[model samples]
Target: MKTLTLDLSGIYTAVTPQSIQAWEEKSNQYQQQLHAGTGLGNDFLGWINLPCEISEEQLSSIEEAARGLQERCDYVVSIGIGGSYLGARAVIEALTPSFEAYQTKHTAPQVIFAGHNIGEDYLSELVAFLRDKRFGLINISKSGTTTEPAIAFRILKALLEEQVGREEARERIIAVTDKARGALRTLADKEGYKTFIIPDDIGGRFSVLTPVGLLPIAVAGFDIRELVRGAREMKALVDESVPFAENPSALYAAARNSLYQAGKKIEILGNFHPRLHYIGEWWKQLYGESEGKDHKGIFNASVDFSADLHSMGQWIQEGERSIFETIVSIAEPNTTLRIESDEANLDGLNYLAGKRVDEVNKMAELGVRVAHIDGGVPNIRIVLPKLDAYYIGQLFYFFEKAVGISGYMLEVNPFNQPGVEAYKKNMFALLEKPGFEAETEAIKARLK
Candidate 1:
């Protein structure tokens, strides 16, 4: 099976070979720290070997639970914020047809997401839409108290119970949360909802190989075993024993950090395939949250090419030289689509009549890379053999491993997100939630 590969040739001009070699040494130390559990976020290093560590029994259990959900529901609402839903959504969107929701036929339940936002109209419309459809809820949170998802689950729970009655609704809900504690775990235990434990050491962003991501992808009818196998294969290829030059993950970490050191602060993850848009979303969260700390790290951004070419192309091509791009290149599209010859040739597209659509896309991609490089942007390309469960799995692990090494290169603790609580504290204070009386008063005074 072909795997995902990273090419840093395009970035060589912007980041010298010597710089990459130096960063590779640093990345090696970081990789060692990760394996030895001696790094800043050592406690969260559970994800370091997660791909290889997942057992067959666990995979079976996850599939079994997903099968139950699939047998019962027409739609499955995966509810979580950030890593919780992003990974699952990324895999599902990449594998499923773009118009699968509108299609009359589908083998698997159509998976949708909620609890990632607090949009009033979004939640209202979701509830209204679920009124007639048979839907199951996959509520994911370490704590059941994350405001957005908590509110969504509350409303959805009530509606589901009213629609199907309490007993059946309990059976339809699956809670993926902490094993020993957390409000969600407690509720799952008490109400007898199917449950999966999110490993205590794995943070949300790195939990894709865990039940957090696998179950949803499985529920959507993708091959979870192949996904896990692909991740495991990548785990072996990027192991500490693999040389820095040969390890794609290490090279990626080294190249990106080298670019950052050279004053390129923004990393744009650009993809030509639209299905990969959410993969970009997931990548942003993975790198942004993991590396963006202590007033440092690259600004992670993304754009879908050919489409965003018309929108953000100008800025990316001629914007500040601080920006660099990493493009995800798909080597082969899944389906064949030829541009047929037109007799009239009025629109003047006849020159490319016999070519496949993907051929044109590849040219556009190559053209953009050359143009962007000329206009002062460095480019990194990650080539996937094809878009499938296995390659996507390989891609996920590649980024996850690279981010860990990259974050350590930036001298920050990637696992813990201390900055995320700043807004939560203010929101809770302004809302006068229970124990924040002093903060509430202080915030009110500041507001006045």
Candidate 2:
């Protein structure tokens, strides 16, 4: 099986080969810190070996539960915020057909998401849509009190029970939360809902290999075992023992940091493949949350190429010189499509009629890289042999490992997200939640 490959050649003009090698010793040291559990946020290092550590029994159980959900529900709503839903959604969107949501029938339940947002009309429409469809809920949260998911779960849980009775609702709902405690876990136990435990050692953003992501990807009918196999293979390839020159993760970490040092502050993840859009979202969270700390880290951003080329293209082309780009290049699309020859030639596209559509897209990809590089932006390319569960799995682990190394290179704790709570505190205070009375008073006085 061919693995994902990284090319830092385009970035050579900005980040030299010698510079990358110079960081090798430091990268290796960071790798040692990760392996030795001696670094900051080491407690969350469970994800470092998660792919290899996943047991066959766990895979079997996830598959069995997924099978049960498929047998019953036509639509399964995966409810969670941030890492809870992003990883699974990214994988599911990448693997499933782009038009699966519009399909009248499917091999497995069409997985949907909620609790990630709190839009009034969005929740209203979701509830109304599920009114006639057979649906199941996968409620994911370590603490059941996260406002968004909690509110979503409350409304959806009531609807599920009222629609299918409490007994059946109990069977349909699955809780992925803390094992021994947490509001969700306590309720799951009391209601006898089938459950999966999110590992205490693994943070939410890094929990994709766990039931947090696996169950939804499985419920969508993708191969979880193959995904894990690919990730495991990548895990071996990027281990501490791998030489810096040969290791993609270490090289990527080094190269990006070198670009950062060269005054390039923004890293844009550009992809030609539309299906990989959510993959960009997941990547932003992974890198942004991990490294964007201490006021020091590359700003993570993304663009869907050829499309965004018209919108954000001008800024990227003529704007600040502090930007760099990383492109996800797919060697082969899953389906073959050829541009048809039109006799009228009105659109003036007949000259390239014999080529596959992917060929044109590949040209656009190449063209953009050249244009962007020429326009003073450094470029890095990641080539995937193809898009599938296995390759996507490899990509996941590849980025995860790279972020770990990159975050350490930036001297930040990759695992902890202390800044995320600032908004939550203000929101709670403004809403006058019971526990935040003092905060509510303080905030109100300030408001007045």
Best by lDDT: 2
lDDT of 2 by residue, 1-448 (tens): 7999999989977878999999989999999999999998998999999998999999999999999899889999999999999999999999988788887778899999999999999999999999967999999999999999999999999999999999999989999999998899999999999999999999888889999999999999999998999999999999999999999999999999999999999999999998999999999999999998999999999999889999999999999899999999899998998999999999999989989999999989999999889999999999999999999889999999999999999999999998899999999999998999999999999999
In model 1, the clashing pairs are none
Measured with C-alpha atoms, the lDDT of residue 326 in candidate 2 is 96
- Ten contiguous residues with the weakest lDDT in model 2: 97-106
- Each candidate: what lDDT? 0.92, 0.94
Worst 10 residues of 1 by lDDT: 19-28
Q: What are the per-residue Cα lDDT tens digits for candidate 1 across 251-343?
A: 898888889889999999999999999999999999999988989999999999999999999899877789999999999999999999999
C-alpha TM-score for every candidate: 0.99, 0.99
Pairs of colliding residues, candidate 2: none
